[model samples]
Target: MDWQYENGRIYSTDENGELMCEATFIRKENGEMDIDHTYVNPVLRGQGVAAQMMEVVAEYFRKEQLKTTATCSYANIWLKRHEKLYPDILSEDTSDQAVACKIDGKH
Candidate 1:
């Protein structure tokens, strides 16, 4: 399976071009991006497809020096598991329910 990123979403496909998984995000007014949705083809569940998508998004955020907010529960949990890689982006207060990411005007 090949995983690819495009249009603020991560997608996976098999050799036959069948969609296996997708993770979507929205760019917020604050120049932050919020991962809002994720879906894995039922047959592809438990195969780490979603994890791969999350990893890609995380790397993109890091490379762009952008903070990320995860509105999707899965993304939230993923972030919790990988806090060290995003310490500067994660909310320090930890009280706000919304996940917010901020970029330093780098876009």
Candidate 2:
């Protein structure tokens, strides 16, 4: 997937411009980023697309020398799963309660 980056989002769209996947974050007052949303189109689910998206997000943070926490459930879990590879990028306050999927309101 061809991901696109913006001020606070990393996402990809189909040829017709329909959203395929997305992860959104907000910059915190403490200078840490809080990942708040993640979405994958149904057609793209079960294909490891969400994991790929998180990898992109992780790489982006590493490249920018930023720290991050994840309020979005998937992101929170993913970060923990890959902590060894991104030790310095995860904030100490990285734990978050489970949240519904932002795009469809599914848990």
Candidate 3:
């Protein structure tokens, strides 16, 4: 499996070039980026695909010196579990308002 990053999104692809999972980050009004969406193909579930994608997203955020709001439920859970790995990028405000706006097309 290989991970590709492009257009502010990360994609996991198999050797055959089939997509296994994907995660996207959207820039918010406050200049922080949100991990707004993530999907792992049902066939690829439980294979650590989402965890790998989250790692890539976290690394990208650190390298770019950007903050992150984990809106995706999986991402939120991952962040909580890996707080030490991303302390600086984790926002102090954990309110779901930003995520809600993004989902409702209000942001």
Candidate 4:
């Protein structure tokens, strides 16, 4: 799927322009990128779309030479799972974000 980029986001939309996948990041004072939210439409779930989005985000970080931490639960988990592939971009500390996420008012 083709992705679109903005200042701190990468996302894709369906033909009708409905958001199909989205990942939003917050830029930290230290130039770290805190991936704060990631979403995949229900229709696209179970298709590895989320992982693909993460890869795109990771590649962006790699290219920009930015450090990454994730406050979004999914992003945090994904970063760890793919740590071996993105060690250079992964932040050394994410404990502060262990309980971070705004989905379903869970934050």
Model 1 per-residue lDDT tens digits across residues 1-107: 57687888888888888888877777878777777777788997898877877887787778878777776778878888888867766554322546433333222
Higher lDDT: candidate 3 or 4?
Answer: 4
Q: Determine the backbone clash count of candidate 4.
A: 0
Instruction: For model 3, state the Cα shift of residue 63 in Å.
Output: 0.7
For model 3, residues 3-73, the per-residue Cα lDDT tens digits are 78897788887778877888888888898888878888899889887888788888888998988887777
- Ranked by TM-score, top first: 4, 2, 3, 1
Which runs in model 2 stand beyond 4 Å of their true positions? 96-107
Candidate number with the higher TM-score (3 or 4): 4
lDDT of 2 by residue, 1-107 (tens): 99999999999999999999999998999999988899899999999999999999999999999999887889988999999999989998875534445655333
Model 4 accuracy (lDDT, Cα): 0.89
lDDT against the true structure, per candidate, is 0.73, 0.89, 0.78, 0.89
Angstrom error of the Cα, residue 78, model 1: value is 0.8
What lDDT would candidate 2 get against the real structure?
Answer: 0.89
TM-score of 3: 0.81
Q: Candidate 2 at residue 23, lDDT?
A: 94
Measured by C-alpha RMSD in angstroms, how accurate is candidate 3? 3.3
